[model samples]
Target chain A: MTRPSPKIGVYGFTGCAGDQLMILNCEDQLVDLFGATEIRSFVMAKSDNHEAELDVALVEGSISTEAQLKHLKDIRERSKVLIAIGTCACWGGPQAMKLGDGKFEERYKKVYGNAKITVSKAIEGQPLDAFVKVDMKIPGCPIDKQEFLKSVSKLVAGKHPYLLKSPVCLECKWKENKCLLLDGKFCAGPLTKGGCGAVCPSHNLPCVGCWGPTDDLNVSAEYDLLKEKGFVPEEIITKIRKFGGSGVMELVKNLEKKEAKK
Target chain B: MMILKMKKEDLPAFLESAKEWGELWGPTTKDGKTSYAKVDSLSQMDLKATRTVIPPKKFLYPPRFTMFDFDEEGFVERTGDVPKRILFGLHPCDVHGILIMDKLFLETYKDPYYAERREKTLLLGHSCIPDDKCMCFATNTDFVAEGFDLFFTDLKMFYLVWVGSSKGHDLVRMRADLFSRNLDKNDILNYTEYRKWKTAQFKAKIDLTGMPDIFELGYNSPIWDELGEKCLSCGQCSMVCPTCNCYNVVDEVDLGTAEGTRDRFWDSCMFREYSVVAGGHNFRDKRADRLRLWYTHKLQAFIGEFGKPACVGCGRCVATCPVDINVATVSTALKEQEVGK
Candidate 1:
């Protein structure tokens, strides 16, 4: 007997929608995906979007507004497996850096200039997990196509998708590119999670921590490392906070406390 | 070795004739970085470049080398699909690096995949003039006396070619029109003098006279932690190092299908996952431990086993590392520091 086709929805909130574009970038592989599962909703690709319950929901972007939060919770209730796609959905992305710096209001006012928006009320962008539980995450500035296919195929087969817990340093080694960090440029490959196939490093560019911190990253040690390398405390924190999200701020707090005690 | 001379103007024609050898690969500029690539024409080759961003080792040992295809009915071995090729204009250090890798791949348990590529490929070595970043002189790999099919040293208006092997002699004979019997005694004298002058040009130096002893005694040195603090554990050193042949074998099964493949890709000792074993225990858990292991392997363990350190001092690692965590600096630290009580 043929297995029932999986019902899936792809949604976006407050990000570049680059992850959605990446899914479409899998042009040849998307045919296989289309055959294997029923794509119920993907506004980026098709117009016929369904509102019914889904077996799997791949969400892109972060929750930055009350309206987006409501929509995210609704999607969570309807989907059995909710996978956060992209750094925006997974770790709040670049927008979350202001929150980490404790200058969100200042930055927000600078942009909007005291004008009250009548549309959706804006809150600091947050990872999908802040509002509802995300079953899995595919982290990247824009999610990698190969990784997306791997996870989607696993979900289609009713199996749990596995991701490497190691940092980008692992893949960077495989590619054998010169380390950007060794040139005295700050690279976060050792701290950020592996899965993007170390793309930026392969091109001899520093990893901007777009994939967020790895599971076992020693943030305090990394902080000390930057300091030892002659980077100012503020400079180090700001560099990490580029894509580090609020978790980096917590690590900074812990590091400051440890330093004070010493 | 049969010594021959070829004029600079005849290089295009000579390279064009070299097509009979197989696919010609030499350093070419791409994306503002010089890397070894397939040269379709004379203009595509940049033999004058100091060092390529990536070495010629990839031709012999590909990044993703497939070992076999498997199913429930055993496996089908991935036989020699290697094309006949010539890796031209390889720097002396890179040539030396290939020789070092041969110790591992060509000896003991022979890797058929690597062996096939090795057998099919011919190395055309080139003499290099060292820049500030080079330490090949300290590593004694600056000038290769052997282990190449042909070695070319640029001599102003001409190229002094040393046909080192029977294969090289065959190629030279095939393109005899490009060669000249007019090569005089002074040309040979100039070649020797130029090599001596080129060797003296290297600025970076590391005294590896007591490396094994230093590495052994400096096991508990605080330098490892200091270096570790700066290291991103990105494995860029090993990746760019031509002699680094470490890899992980993985059996990747196609989703919803029984067919699978046994593939091997490059692995790094710097990675935390590299030391992780069964039951989820990582022996080299700390970043410092991993960094120490990498340095020890390159400078000590390999030397103890192979009678020579694995590094060829190509300066690729020095030039590529983002944090400027140089191998020479680490070696100097080990040599200068005394073992703490």
Candidate 2:
């Protein structure tokens, strides 16, 4: 007997729908993806998206508004498994860089001014885990296309998708690219999670840490290396904070605490 | 082992004739970085290069490759298609690295992938000038005796070539006029002088004496933690090291299909995920623990098992590591109980 295809829903909240676009960009694999899985809801790809119970929910973007927070809860309630896709949904992306900085009000006012009544009140951007449980995370600025496809296939086959947790340096070395840090560049390859195939470094550009921090990130070491290379503390922090989001912020805070105790 | 001499000018003609054996590959410099690339003749190669960015192991065991293509029915081994190639300009330490690899991949369980590539490829060793990073003297691998088909030693006016195997002799026979077996007293004196000059040129003083004992004594030392903190865990040292041969395998399924190809890629013990197993139990979860395992394996465990350290002292780690955490630094730190800059 043939197994029934998993019912999947793809959703976007506040950030650019780049992850969903990445899925669409898999033009060669799209036909097979459509044929194998019952894509019950993919608003970006199809119009007739039903908000029904789903076996898996591929969620992209951060919960920035009250409506999105509510929508995320509803999505979690309707889905058996919710995998956060993209840096935005995984760690609040660049939008949540200043999270807990206590300057959101001033920044919001500066950007949006005094707008009248809105459909949903704007709130501080947060990852899906802030409201509901996130079963897994497929991280990138826009989620990597091959990783997205692999994750979907693994989930469909009733297997856990394995994500590479190593830093970008591994892939950089595999590509045989010269280390930018060795050349006195402020490369984030050693601190950021890989799986982008070391794309930036392969092209002679430094990694921007867009895939977020690796689990075993050596923040202080990276900071020290950059500092030794003549990068100011402020410049290093800004570079790390660009896509590091809440995960790296927590690590940095913990590092500071450890250092203080020392 | 037939020792012959060829004039420096006739070397290019000999190399041109040697191409009949396979695709000639040698160290070629690009953008100030040297790596092995296909070359037409000796003139296209940077024979003076100290070391290639990636070692000769890449030709035998590639960074990544498909092992098998499988559907729902069965797995079809993706063997064959390995082209016959000649790898030229391998330094003595690199040839020693290949010998260690032979003991690992060509013996015991025997990896067919590495075996197939090894069978097809021929190693052509070349003499090298000792740079500041060269530590092969400490490892006693500065002059290789085996593991290469041919070895060429530059004696300024002429090249003293050692025909290591029958294949090398065949290549020499192809260009018989370019080579001469006649050797005078001056050739021996010149070779001795060259060895003396090479020995004095080593600037990196890496002594691996009693490494196993030192590693055992310093098992729980705080130095591991200190080095771990500094280590990026980038695995660049492993990638560039001539003797590092760790690999990881994965089955990549095609989208929406059960069919896929099983692929093998270079893996490093430095990676946090390397020691992770089922049910989320990471054996070497701490970077310190991982760092200790890598060094212990290279300097201690491999010594116990193979009677020699896994590190060939090619100085790839010295050149590659960004934060100064290499065999030289780590071993020195263990021995001296102090980390060096």
Candidate 3:
């Protein structure tokens, strides 16, 4: 008896499309992917794609326009499992960073001042979860490929994906690498999630908190440490707010008060 | 193990004798900096030298070597066979990095390209002749360890060599009377003293004792943003790092045919495109995170893995980085923070 292959589709939105490229990056497992299941749609990888009800739909990019909102709702309706891939889809990626500093009209003016812009009306770009419920999220600017394939293959086999959140600091420990802390190398491995295999540190650099803060973290303590280093409260908040943006703004107030003491 | 003291006059003979075993590649002076490349004459081998600009890992894992040739039709071909070559003149820090990479390639996915080359090759280590740029002592990698067949220490006219494996003994056996004939406690102690002298020469100016406290506090330090403004994102800091092994795997078509190879080449997380997704989503999209990620991995996360920082403290990143983002300066700033805290 032959079993029916699952229908899977991949979609993208308004971004550099590097995350999807990262998936295509798995050259070895790609053939295995084609062999395992029926790829219903993947705009960048293939031209011939179906848009019917999908067993699993992997989406990247954010909701920047009304068209994207309608498309996301349709995806949510049709797909059994909707996995948001990359930070923009999972958490508002880079574009979401400029929330408060200015209005869209002003910022747009600054970039394309007073031009009759008829491209797409701005609608505060947000993660997919904002428009439609996300079953699971594979975070990162572009999620790590090994984990991505494992999830896709698992889904194809009718298994749940194993999401990792052990923190980049844990992988650092696993490698038996020296703690940059002892050398006074201020690092956020404790706060940020792992799965990148500590690539930054291996290059004699520190973690920039790109993987996003772990679920269980002491953000305040790190704040205190920075203050002790004589760093300004505004500077520290702006740095972390790069990835976490609004998620981190609330924490900035406490930091500023601490800096006021001295 | 037998050892013989080769007279300074017989250095060329020693070089020629070693060639019978295999092609010996050591430190050759290029533009006055010690770089590992093929050499024919003994004078070309900077016997008394500074550290090589690049680690010998490049020989096994070339910066952009092809992994294999593959085709659109799935005709997978692998270039797993590596030539038998001898790599000499590795500093202790570099030797340590080689051992770490051995764990990466030999253990996990069984990287045939790295492992195949590594298995067929011999490793030779040399002690450091202290220089202002050298920082092995900062990471405690100044002393020789395993991963080398022959370990050479410069003792003025004569070289103190330690044969680690069978290969080392074979090299020593080839030269009957040139190397020291017998090993005694005194000779071992003399070498130990030389290593200690080398350590004193480096004398890591900043103590690494209070790293955790300093780093924990420096987590929100303003130095990163200040430095981020100057960064070019060229990834030079990552390129010259001995332990930095991030790579990008790519598929290419062979000639005009569908037959091509999938290969993994060195990649840096610093590049803006490193974390970008096809959907235009970038998690660490900010320049600060890129800068922060580099230091965090080296300082905090690397410590969690290997119980040592990933950086060899070679200052190559500082030298090569277009922005001059020096880890030493960062560490000093953290030290001051620890005191302030």
Taking every candidate in turn, the Cα RMSD to the unseen true structure, in Å, is: 4.8, 1.7, 10.9
Q: Tell me the TM-score of each prediction against the true structure.
A: 0.81, 0.97, 0.55
Candidate 1 Cα deviation (angstroms), residue A255: 5.8
| Ranking 1 against 3 by lDDT, winner | 1
In the range B223-280, model 1's lDDT, one tens digit per residue, is: 8887776666656676778888888776665544446677787777877888999899
How many clashes does the backbone of model 2 have? 0
Model 2 residue B184 CA deviation in Å: 2.2
For model 1, what is the error of residue B315's alpha carbon versus the real structure, in angstroms, after optimal superposition? 1.3
Q: Candidate 1, what DockQ? A: 0.29
Worst 10-residue lDDT window, candidate 2 chain B: B250-259
DockQ head-to-head 1 vs 3, winner: 1
For candidate 2, what is the DockQ-based docking class? medium
Deviation from truth (RMSD, Å), model 2: 1.7
Residue range with the least summed lDDT across 10 consecutive positions in model 2 chain A: A251-260
Ranking by TM-score: 2, 1, 3
Docking class of 1: acceptable
Candidate 2 wrong stretches, greater than 4 Å: A109-114, A257-262
Q: lDDT tens string, model 3, B276-311?
A: 787979877665677778877777777877687777
lDDT of 2 by residue, A94-177 (tens): 898877678888998998888774688889888888889999999998889998998888777666777788889888887778
